[model samples]
Target: MGTDVRDETRNATSLLESNLMAAAKDLRNETRKATRTLERNLMAAVNEIYKRITALEQVLGWYRAGNYNLYKVFTERANYTESLENCEKYGARLAVDGIIDATILRDLIDNLINSTDYGTYVGLDDRAKEGTFMWLSGKPLIAGEVRWNSGEPNDDLGGGQDCAYIRAEAWNFDDHYCETKLNYICEKMA
Candidate 1:
């Protein structure tokens, strides 16, 4: 009778262990399925966003550079004030960051533009106070951050060369008259 009781106890323990192991295996399989589904959904969303951006780039002629804003090169020539207004109409502003990237600006010009002798107008100007250049965003344009043209940012005579522009020949800032009509780059800043 004691042997029979001992055999029954052992059988019960073995059954319990087997059930627990099966349950654990089932839980792991379910977790893996959930993770794979989440990964697939994330990839699909990313692809959709990429397609929309590509379509907009083609239609609006807006180009984007590495870690930079989406910019559009307007061939229509306009002076400083007019260019500012034009960018505003499109719900954007001029690329008037304190530090301008001459290489990216040059790539946008050389690759996108066909011809322009008047150069392109940026938002830097000394209009508020003479000899004190500032961006359109009310930030001062640091001299060290810019690649100014050779002997640039100088007014040969009073009220001359107050506005800054990027020359087509090279990607460097050159002071120009505010009224000079030139191509522009309207940047949609992030």
Candidate 2:
């Protein structure tokens, strides 16, 4: 009878051990699945942050000039031709757009000049013929379309005063010698 009782106790203990082992295995599997889900969600959040940073960097690279996004760089006094060349390197050109565009440039240039002796060069020129002003693209300037400083484009200064510049005081267009070194503004498509 004693031996029979011991055999029954051993059998019950073995069955309990088996049940515990299976429960532990199931718990480990569930933990692994939860870990995988957490990793996937974290990676998605990091990727979204990276995309937003890139967009902000692009916006920081440019500046607002009225209705246009422009890149303005201060350079050592350079000839009109040299200024144009420099602008070309950055995929921009000398600022010579419509009247409204030019006006915005004038305001910006005026603020920058602020009692400085140097002025800024624009893309307008009469190189094709004196008194026949035109934008750099060869588009003729309509007489009343653009405002010029009093007694400007007079060609009175001589020495090939044909490149248009912004006068600091009036912020109006005035022809100057192309060879004169000065600061300049560059424009690009927004």
* Most lDDT-accurate candidate: 1
lDDT of 1 at 174: 84
**What is the TM-score of each predicted model, taking all chains together?**
0.77, 0.60
**Predictions in order: lDDT:** 0.78, 0.73
Q: For candidate 1, give the lDDT.
A: 0.78
For candidate 2, what is the TM-score?
0.60
| Model 1 Cα lDDT, one tens digit per residue, 68-182 | 5777778789998899999999887877642266666556666564356658887788888889989888878776868888877777555577888888787678888888899
Pairs that collide in candidate 1 are none
TM-score of model number 1: 0.77
Per-candidate count of clashing residue pairs (backbone under 3 Å): 0, 0
